[model samples]
Target: MATLEIKEVAKRYGDRTVLHDINLTLASGEFLSLLGPSGCGKTTLLRIIAGFEHPDGGQVRVDGQDITALPANRRQMGMVFQAYSLFPNMTAEENVRFGLRVRKVDAAEQSRRVLELLELVGLANHAAKYPHQLSGGQQQRVALARALAIRPSLLLLDEPLSALDAKVRVQLREEIRRIQRETGITTVFVTHDQEEALSISDRVAVMYEGRMVQVGAPAAIYQEPTHPFVAQFIGISSRLPARVVDADQGVITVLDRALHTPRARGLQPDVALHLYLRPEGVQLQAVNGKDPQSAVLQGTVRESTFFGAVTRLRVELDGGQGVLADLSTHEALQLPIGIRVHVSWQPDAMRLLPAELPI
Candidate 1:
């Protein structure tokens, strides 16, 4: 186990800059995930950490030792790529033993380590099978075992589960987390999938166009996103136009209804604002009786979609604005389309941001 640090990292390709002033620190045995959309520089940052690519300007350190100039082979890092890079002619056991053989470990130690890694990845019985005879999931397990056989100080996973089927991806992700915990290895996983990053990481760093937008625990990133980009990108949300009626008092007016909100810095009175509300934050109730503590907006159900235990309803406000509300399937069926309903949410559930902010 070791601590990993990336300080002031920057990368550029010709005139386009992909990474800018990237700085992050990982504690010993911590699992940190780099999450973003395609072309967001997550994979590039991972390559820099693995010593596969040099940063234009920065330092990569492991346990207080500078490794920015170290070559890939001497960095003590193990990388598992998206495609299974197993040798087709090598059996599973031999593939796991190859790393040890490169380092010239004795035959006895190599054999013991191979057995342990195969068992660790739950491929002990298939030790004699070659990559050609194994399933995609099995092949990935072999690759993981091979990466771990050398006992690297850091483990880098570059979208290692993207090519598998949905079921297999979920299963393998859980297995990877289990193995990481068992070995307590410092890991950096790069993925474009938000669910994967949120489900398995101790901390998540959300990136956008060469810059990190937010870094926090999964719940924090989901519940309290500091930037408008983060609130919209991290989850499903409905945006409605609003106005800051009283900035000092943290009051806003939406759809001609006055409501109090949290104070935001740099907000001025009478400025146009955008209110962001998550589906789970919006509540639907019959229009007759209403909750006084919540801010209510009258709307009619436009459509409802059932997704197993949960149902999502699209409600169109009297002003022609649409908002989404999530409810139990049982409850949603009680209210059909065209039925008048009251949409309400807690004051704290809505986020206020400048309307000019892009995305």
Candidate 2:
């Protein structure tokens, strides 16, 4: 229910810079995710926002109030960590009531709030159970209920479901999203899992090495990545060598096969670039189709993997380059091994980025 803003935030540890000019804004009631690989400063940035760690520069504002120098407790933010750090001695209801008690709520109010929160998290029946008596998912639900007991202005989640089993993780993720939407609490989630971020966030900031690489809706970031690092980091895709053959008409040639460029406004001819095409975007053609304007590459099916719902095929181009294709089991059943196939993709599905990347 509050807008969070981080302006030009910088964090450092002695001589090493951990975060550099991280600028982001979260709309009121929006769920924003900070996503990146391990050691990429995603957690460091979350800590800074939570007021657990101070930034060297810039400001942290909540509802237009600068809270840069405020202590973690005074910031009035709720945090849920990867580990369910619940008190072992306290029962579920007692643990959820701790925050209200700390804030000096009356006994009657605390009891009502704790019960409501437990019910909200679907743990009302287990209110009398201790931490050791509950499963990992149940423990995390208790943690969430406790965090909500405070009714803080912002909710910060650092891989809150990472420790749970896969089935529990999926269920808990939906539960968390439902809770957030119902409460309308502004949330900042940090995770290294790309699928988790893409599936749950209203918007995501893709970070790399202490810098924000790209920030956008999941669809935009996945379909039209602006940088090679962003494209490679966000999802599975093939990057093929290409040349700018026509700058005016947005044309690029790959392996002497010309294809229309994907909205490269200022590209120059003979420049080296990369064409990013995802596996799902490529289609297998046994023979030439009627789409004359489309560019197709003939490759031999090198390997195929059957994965129940879908099958994956690896095709080797004439130049020895490889492209991966994913098909449903029914579609894959039509093709066999060592078959020469033409791989075709829509022009708009192609994403272009500079071939040479920094690091």
Candidate 3:
């Protein structure tokens, strides 16, 4: 276990800047995920930390030592890339033992360590199976075991699960988290998948256009996003156009209702804003009467998607704007596409962000 620090790290490729002045710190054994879209620089930052790429400025430190100039092999870190990268002719045991053999560890110790890691990754029974004989998931497990064989001070994963199928990805991610906790190795995971990052990380760092936009625990980042990009990128949410009708009272008009949000407190009147309404915050009701006077809003379902316990819907409102409503699977059965329904939201669940956004 070790504390990792990245201080003012910046990177550039010719005229294009790959990373901005980024600063982050992780406690011993802490697991942090860098999450963003395809070109958002998360991978670049990970490579910089892994010593594969040098930053134009700043430093990378582990346990108070500035290792910015250290070669990757000397950094004492284990890395798992998206590709399994296992040796084709080598069996699981031999693959995991390769690092130990290169480091000139005692032969007896290498055998013990290889077996221990193969067991740790739940591959002890398949130790003699070559890479070609293993499934994608199994091959990844061997790669993970090989990386852990060195008992590295740090573990870096660059979307290691992306190449696998969805179901396998979930299972392997959970397995990875368990292995991480058992080993207590400080880990830096880079991925574009929000669910993966949110599900298994101690903390999540959201980056956009090479800048770290927000960093927080999973729930905090989901519930209280500080940036508009963070709010939009992290989950499914609807943005209803609104206007700040009364800033003095922190009031904003959404559809027909005047809702109060602290974010509207200092905004000028009539300034355009977007009210972020999460699907889970909405409640759908059958319209039994004309006008539906008790309803907060009304819309026709544009899309309905059932996700096990809950069903998410895209409801198109009166003026072509839309909001997503999440309903019980039983209730969603009653409402299909093009069905009109009443929509009401829990005020505490909505968030307000600046209407304008970066391109």
What's the TM-score of every candidate structure? 0.95, 0.96, 0.94
For all candidates in order, the CA lDDT equals 0.91, 0.88, 0.91
Sorted by TM-score (best first), the order is 2, 1, 3
Candidate 2 has which clashing residue pairs, if any?
A: none
Best-to-worst lDDT order: 1, 3, 2
Q: Per-residue lDDT for 1-359 in model 2, tens only?
A: 89999999999999999899889999999999899989889999999989889999999999999999999999888999999999999999999999899999999999999999999999999999999999999999999999989999999999998898889988998899999999999999999888889988999999988998899999998998987888999888987898888888877788778766546557877889888888887788664444433436878888999899989888898798888888897887777888877888866567878898754
After aligning candidate 3 to the native by TM-score, how far in Å is the CA of 110 from where it should be? Answer: 0.9
Instruction: Tell me how candidate 1 scores on lDDT.
Output: 0.91
Evaluated against the true structure, the overall lDDT of model 2 is 0.88
Q: Model 3 segments beyond 4 Å from truth?
A: 266-270, 288-295, 334-339
**lDDT tens digits, residue span 1-359, model 1:** 99999999999999999999899999999999999999999999999999999999999999999999999999988899999999998999999999899999999999999999999999999999999999999999999999999999999999999999999999999999999999999999999998999999999999988888899999899888877777878888898989988777777788998777665435788888788898887888877665455646889999999899999999999999999999899999988999988788865567887777553
Instruction: Put down candidate 3 lDDT per residue, 212-322, tens digits, no spaces.
Output: 999999999999887889989999888888899899999888886766667788788997878888889888876767655446777899898889999888889878888
TM-score of 3: 0.94
